[model samples]
Target chain A: MLEALRKISDVVWELPVTHKAGMRVPARIYGTEKLLQEMDEAVFDQISNVATLPGLVKHAICMPDGHFGYGFPIGGVAAMDTEEGVISPGGIGFDINCGMRLLTTNLTAGEVEPYLKSLVDLLFGRVPAGVGSRGSLSLSRTEFRRVLEEGAHWCIENELGRPEDLARTEEHGRIAGADPSLVSEKAIDRGIHQVGTLGSGNHYLEIQAARPADVYDPELARAFGITLPNQVVIMFHCGSRGFGYQVASDYLKVFLKVMEASYGIKILDRELASAPFRSPEGQDYFAAMKCAMNMSFANRQVILHRIREVFADVLGRSAEDLEMHMVYDVAHNTAKLERHLVDGTPRELLVHRKGATRAFGPGAEDLPAAYRETGQPVIIGGSMETGSYLLAGVSSGDQAFFSTAHGSGRTMSRTKARRTWRGRELWREMEERGIYVRTASWAGLAEEAGAAYKDIDEVVEATEMAGISKRVVRFTPLGNIKG
Target chain B: MPYEFLEDVATADIAFEAWGSDLEEAFSAASEATLNVMVEEPGAVRPLETREIHLEAEAVDVLLLDLLQELVYYKDAEQLMLRVDDLEVTGGPPFRLDALARGEHLDPERHRPRVDVKAVTLHRFRVEKTDRGWRASVILDI
Candidate 1:
């Protein structure tokens, strides 16, 4: 697989269409030479498989953080012609709209350091975590229907958040066209008690600080709402929980049953089960998918409410007094309709980004007025021991349909990480380095050891070099609540 | 051990292979491995409740996938952590399986929550008859 890659540039490699049979287009990979050499061989196979799917425009692209996933490689990007393309649940992960949210604070690390432990402890107690964790708000089947339609508006109207928060969120915290009638009873049952809960297996809420030294573009940093040196901030990663999973599971079976018979499409991987974009089954999944998307937006909005309450109570100050305003919220897993130039022709494409974040450049439509001049703020989370990054989109990002790397993708498998380190010991080591940590399970923490992931600096740098996104600021961990 | 977790099969998810003297035992072992991924101690879960399961699939592999998905569904809908107490498997164009699941709602105190498995994936999912008996390989999304 490595030998088959032809270097396109310093950071781009091409897997020619002739390399695989039935490939509609070639596969392109973005990464440094060193990063490419270390990539798993399975990544090549998976990306190549994605290239064979019908209605793909241009090439199948994999970002710097790429790794082999179930059907599509993680950090992958593909744009399909909406009028003639297909929609696959495998393209968008089971965790529909699993995304990241970041907020800026007027308070400095110095002010929060005194009570960091208290803040984290309170957050752990206030926001539910781990398997089968339930939140404070319990909704009925009927109320959940409203949540699927209104998204974050439901939370704000319920007094869980401020209205301005919607402005900083993608799609304004709500994805429309959700046919609640299409959502199943099983999915609603799973969603009823799971809102506002931080689920396990890589989901986390961490308190971090940005020092002036870590700011790469000071001008862009301030534009994105980082005003002071040693400033404190909040960033959390989660998804729609079980409601989204059930939706994807339900559709996977539906597509499998009809894909070969009704659509006459054959896939290399069964997980890649898909239906034509205009097919009855496909449109039904889209409407049902919007429900899960809105549910996740509401889920994160409620979690934000819990965080604000904990900070205010712990610091003996009003949330307003602390100036905890949101920076941006970006979804890494989703399929959306967008207009992009394909071979010099403007076309509407259904972009599927799994483990990839949309990094639309400055002046792109749908961006809030405040971000029109600075492009979209992209949040890239690192492992607990390592730091996370903030980047912004550039016009050059159009090379890959305005998509960028999602995170510091894992290098070692969970089994290897568990065999190498004890979670209890890793917790002690992080504390020694000034990162206060709290988690529901120690064994689970071991699986996310910093050493288990690729170097975040290298991953972020490769994206910038590829001109997909540019770095703005780096954040160091101060405290964490691992679900 | 009837089952063992495998490395290199999946990078970001969990994968395991299980075996037994026959098809029923192979399915049972796969259930235990799946439970172990969510809880630190399987034995700690006492049989505080029982739920009946009846499913029919066109193939053996689909049968195993559907059965495992039932466990994931109950975890979210009712917060239950169920274990297969006993099961009966019959082969045909439409394979049939009936089982009694016994466990309790997830109690963080006893179950010792590890990772919440979101769903089971068809990526490399398989069931095969071996010289000794049967084996099943499964991958889970987290």
Candidate 2:
């Protein structure tokens, strides 16, 4: 892989446009030599394929946590000219708007340590998880459509979360232009009962604490609500569930049939199925995708409400007394219309981020007043055994289209991880280390062993060095509920 | 091989290929392999309730994908872990599949659920006829 890549800087590599004939732009990768070596060679192939797509501006890029994926590398970030460029469901991935949310509390680890086990059990019971786990609330067809259109705002309207949560979420927890008519009935059927549920494999809700020693930028950490060591927080990872999957699957078929036959477009991989962003088919897909994105926000919002209720029950205090306020929520997978400076002139581009986080710099008008001076809060999750990080978007991030690595990307396959460790044993080990864990499937836990993923510290270091995003605080897990 | 898991097809997802003497046998084995990924055993599912599935796609590989996704829909929407009871495939530029599946609503004690396959991705998806009869390969996003 190194033989085909040209080192552009200490932490950047480039794949020349000459590598592929139809390529419209070069491909750039951010990583250290060691981290680059750890990446699968297929990532280069996938990213290069992405570069060949129509109207791709600047370059096809990948973050330090880059890994092999179907059409686009998991950590890929690309921007396309709205008029000529295309939109691909594979680029956004199956789990539309799969993202992370962090909630800050006044409580500390010491104050909650004694009840950590019970907290874990309570949270595990409250948040529906595992395969086929239906959410506590069942939505009728009409109510479900409202969720698709309203996003987290639906949760707020239903009294699941405070209005403040909407302020801190990406796109204010709701993206406009969702058309329920564009979404298929099968997609709605799959999503109706799955709201507020955590789907299996790599999805989790964790209780974490930030130690003083783990603080990276003290002032920034404080601004983001991290006050002192062991400050308690709750974080969860999930997506649109089966609704998003069906939407992507349903559209890939449309793009595959229309791209070549109607638009005369050609692609190297079928998984990269796409349509011009301005075409009728593309607009229809974008509309349907917004519905899935909104549904996901609503799903996480409902889960947040559940967490608050569980805490109140276990701690014997009102949620207000606990001060369980949301810090921020960010999506890792999405395609959005944004205006960015290209060659010193602003251009409207559809930015696609797959396994990448949007890290808009400070003073961006879209940010709430509290974050306007501090920049968007980027929540990066790690494995259950490893610690996670809270980073703030930096002005320097415009170099990579304002995107950064989403998480510690997987390094090993599920089969390999399961073969190396037993889930039952790992659960016991985590418990011994003071991290309580409740899982629906033990074998599923083995598939997510920390060893299966790239080291978070190294990935974050490379991200910072590449001028994408800067760290604010580091958080270690206290207890977790894994699906 | 009747059916076997494939390593290295994807980084985090699972992939497998199923073979058969005919298309029906191959499709049945593929469906079984997918269910087996979620539960300890596919044989453990009794034929208590039966659900019918019909799929139409532009290509043969897509026919397989639609079929798998149908089964996944049942698992997520209805909480049913099904085993393919019967299957049939026929026709042209537009391919079609008719299948019957049997299973029961998941019971944690009995199913010992392993993982939920979120979707059948087009990554490395293929369907081909070999000297041994027929084969299909799929990579599932979990």
Candidate 3:
């Protein structure tokens, strides 16, 4: 049974607290009417279930890309009082800190067009990808622990990147409170050889072009070094590699037991198993989770170093001349301690963004000084065949705990996509469109075909119109490396 | 009874599903199937070492996730390819479990991963009973 949606605005709809049992707050969804109609009813049910969790503050929000996920919708956002609320693994997702990083180069598409294939090959050789892929850098147990705690800072210390790179990253590349001891030996072993690797699925490294229509503001483009039509840029998406995976696996076992004994909270979905934020188990998981976040940060930083190396080798130019500066790095799957306005009063909350992005508006104190005026750059990745987007945070995101959509959101099942599309044909099509693709598995490639997801442009438009975030620029893919 | 492998990806209706009569049997079958989803053969895994595993979950599905994660942990960290020998699950707010898993050193020819399951997800997860026996379905966070 479904309840009538209460319209908050043309783009906002609310599921009242009365819609479900044990609901501590309402559930709000931001989407256009067309997009809302496309969503399954279960997405609403999951959002309602999230609202029912104890100590939830404000509303459980779903961005325009919202779709049915584990306990919470994929594009779900929820903030809970850190002192009294709960933390669920489902809210943080499996790939901890699975995020996007944008790199801006001084070269235009015309300058790189002749050497696109060579550049793609160099990048493919440098970045190890695909399922169960291992990287060139292998760390011992001691070094692995240090990497977990220091994140990108560790890479910078090792001369993999410059000091300036840390300031442009979220949380300055290291999340505090990470305890390496909490990580299990098994987790440590799994992650030792996986740093700088791009593990399979939707993760990718891409070269893109910014067209004139894609550029929202000319001045903004000029400032960001994205001035010319068909300017070349790089955007890569990945996470803490195997390290994050192992951390989540180890902690979920602990949390499952803690939820049962401590809270007596019975959830219909096993994936929604959770614990009170104040509990010892909760603290332990948070600490270990932060370690995973840091590990991923280091992984991305190392990959960026590899990218820089490949560019220098192929272009025959100094790294400085390439101007491969990081535009921004933002996490899509994470839970962060944040302060937000709830009912016009400031409250400390543990904000969980599963398949969502933190879209902090302009003048946010947390933002780096260089980006404070432009707000957080929300990199929304689409499939390899389609285009990705860059969006700026809007003030209205404060109502949703400063959250927005992460990606295009899957509309078709992987099985269906694989059955309908052929990898070879898809690869040829992308090649015809001047997009080079390097993939490990044909079946995996078929599963990630662009047709399997909703239109990214439509999804971003809905988010912008809903006031959750505003579009900044579009980057059309020129080449992609997928695992 | 003979066992058969089922190929259900983490998706809408056709997720990773398994069936058996009792809790141990249901869990064992599900564990075997989950490993099969990652690799080609679970039966080919010889019992090289035996490990004791005790886990707790809020429900049957959570219990399944814990169970599967343990196997993944063993496979990835220890380089052991495992198959569940026994599984017993008790239900409550905090469910308890006792399990035995056995695996040999990784044999590349026998065990090649189809996909790396980053983690097990609670999204659209369900474990219930049908007229024939018990059944469970879960979406892996890949």
Per-candidate TM vs. native? 0.99, 0.99, 0.89
DockQ of each: 0.84, 0.78, 0.32
- With candidate 2 superimposed using the best TM-score fit, by how many Å does residue B96's alpha carbon deviate from the native? 3.4
| Alpha-carbon deviation at B103 in model 1, angstroms | 0.2
Model 3 TM-score, 2 decimals: 0.89
What candidate 3 gets wrong by more than 4 Å, as runs, is A1-3, A266-268, B1-14, B19-32, B39-67, B78-113, B122-136
C-alpha positional error of residue B132 in candidate 3 after TM-score superposition, expressed in Å: 5.6
Per-residue lDDT over A352-411 for candidate 2, one digit per residue giving the tens place of the 0 to 100 score: 999999998998788899999998899999988998999989898988989999999999
- Residue A461 in candidate 1, Cα distance off native in Å: 0.6
DockQ, computed on Cα atoms, for candidate 3 = 0.32
Q: Between candidates 1 and 2, name the one with more favorable lDDT.
A: 1
What's the fnat for candidate 1, on a 0 to 1 scale?
0.82
Instruction: Show pairs that collide, candidate 1.
Output: none
Residues A212-283, model 3: lDDT tens digits? 889986665665567777888899999987778877767776777778777787776666778888888888
Tell me, per candidate, how large a share of the native contacts it keeps. Answer: 0.82, 0.72, 0.35
